[model samples]
Target chain A: MKKIIMEKEAGRFCENKDIAKKLREEIIEPTIREKEPVIIDFGNVSGATQSFIHALVSNVIREYRDQAFDNLLYKNACLEIQKIISIVYNYMQLD
Target chain B: MDEKWVNVNPAQLALTAALALKVGKENAIIQSQNIPLSARYLDRMGLYNFFSTPSPFRQYRKKEPAGRFVPISIIKNGDDQSKFVTDIIPLYHLSEKNSRILSYIVGELVRNVLEHSFSEDGAVVAAQYYKESNRISFAICDTGIGLWKSLQIWHPKTDKEALSLALTPGVTGTTLELGGTSENGGAGLFFIKSIVKISRSYFVIMSGDSEYTLLKTRPDIKNRLYSDPFKDHYAFSNSISRFNGTLVAVDLKLDSTPEFQKLLDDIGDIYDSAVKESRRKPARKPKFI
Candidate 1:
């Protein structure tokens, strides 16, 4: 399993898409390709933008479909962050 | 320009700041003489800082901005954006719940500038809290490619058309795909507009020679979110003096704000349906034998 701590890279508010892109390219995509589970920890992240959340995970969801949902996990997300995550997930999964 | 009285909102102030930056400090000049007493608010808002010309008003003690306003600031990159978001909440004395809404707006708008606008001068931003109205008004302006230019890939014929597409849910300059590219969902402006709409506030966007303003929702009107921007009560003009960049301003009533999570849930649902509906295939015409 691969663990990525969001606060360490994105500070308290995770709104930087550059960092999101980097994490997706460097960590999330690689781990998912290896067929290993990945956990993205949002501990200490007070808030996040829908764009930030979208940039971070939308590609994985697009490429991997069900495996991405089953293998990827979000940890310590506040209600706001969870809503944003769900928004991205729903729209991206829509046919 | 000199007037007997001066009144301006955060959006106007941010635009002035951006213009000053664009004109360069040496070329930029503010008429300092015979300035109205009401113009002191301009000085307080830090407008003079961007100009090489001296401030017309006499120097006063610098006051702390907490619980009142955030003076004009320039956000050039991600680091600057993050720091601004962190520092702005205390400046407004906003509670955690309130801060989330403001942060979300700032984050999405400024990031739009950094990633899409391509303005080396970056985004000029300012905010003010009104005690009487119990609301906050903020604006972001960039001296980069305007909406028409940004949406050229999608073939927006005019600035007005570009503004319309920009506010449409899930339509982004990055890609024509239904869900948008991985990096952009094209939902930032739509989300911001919905928040302001539900709060019964005003939202405005200007680019090139066109501008679109979402008029304040009347109390008697039922609050409804629309995927099409023009369906809402609004004022639009295509004859405004051409501006080479983009400006977005919003007035959000703090008192009227619904719970942040609930607001998102409602907006999310509307956004999903809009995307799904857009992707729906058209019904086939009856076949002629």
Candidate 2:
């Protein structure tokens, strides 16, 4: 299992898509490809923009589909973060 | 700028700052002499710092911008964006709940400029809290490629068309696909517009020769979120003097702000429905045979 701490990567407010893209490309994608469950921890993060959340996980959801959902875990996300993540999941899954 | 009495909002201030940067210090000048007392707000907002021409008015003691306003700032990269978001909440004297909404708007708008504007000078941002109105107003502008140019791959024939597509829920300049690519969902502006709408406030976007303004929703009327911006009450003009880059300004009424999670739920529902509806293949017309 691979753990990604959002605060360490994106600060308390995760709005930077560059950092998000980096996390996806460098960490999330590789772990998901290996079929290892990945946990994205948002413990200290206070809020996130929809764009940042979109960049971070939209592609993984697109590529992995059901497996991505089954293996990917979001821990300690605030309500705002969860809504944003859920929004991205819903839209991306529409395809 | 030499008007006898000048009154401008944060949007105008940021736009002027962007114009100053574009004209360069040598060509741009501000005449401070003969200015009205009200013009002091200009200096207070740090507009003078952008100009090479010195202020003719005597300098006043500087005050910390705690709980009132954020002066003109240039944000060039992600680090600057993060720091600005962190620092802005206290400046507005916003509560933790209120701060999230402001942070989200600022973050998405500034990030749009950084990622797409292609302006070396980055984004010029300014904001003020209107104590009388119980609202916050802010603007972000860039001298980089404007919306028309940025959306060129989509073959937008005019600036107005580009602005329309840019405001749509799922369309993006980055891709022709419905859901958009990983890095861009093209929903930033839409979400911002929705937030402003829900608050019954105004949101404006300008680029090239065109501008679109989301008019304040009437308090007496039912508020409905629309995936298509034009469906809402709005004003538009293609005749505005051409601006080479993009500028967006928002007025958020703090008092009217719904709970943060509730706002998200509302926006998320609209967004999901919009995307899902777009992807739904139109029902084939009944056979005429």
DockQ of each: 0.80, 0.82
lDDT of each: 0.89, 0.89
Q: Score chain B of each candidate by TM-score.
A: 0.94, 0.93
Residue-by-residue lDDT tens digits, candidate 2, A1-95: 89999889888999988899999999999999999999999998999999999999999998998788988999999998999999988888675
Badly placed stretches (over 4 Å) of model 2 are B1-4, B31-33, B276-289
True contacts kept of each: 0.77, 0.83
Alpha carbon deviation, residue B85, candidate 1 (Å): 0.5
Question: Candidate 1: where is the Cα deviation over 4 Å?
Answer: B1-4, B279-289
lDDT accuracy of residue B87 in candidate 1: 75
**Per-residue lDDT tens digits of candidate 2, residues B265-288?**
999989988766645678889888
Estimate the TM-score for candidate 1. Answer: 0.95
Per-residue lDDT value at A52 in model 1: 96
In model 1 chain B, the worst 10-residue window by lDDT is B272-281
lDDT of 1 by residue, B54-94 (tens): 77777767667887888999999988998898876757778
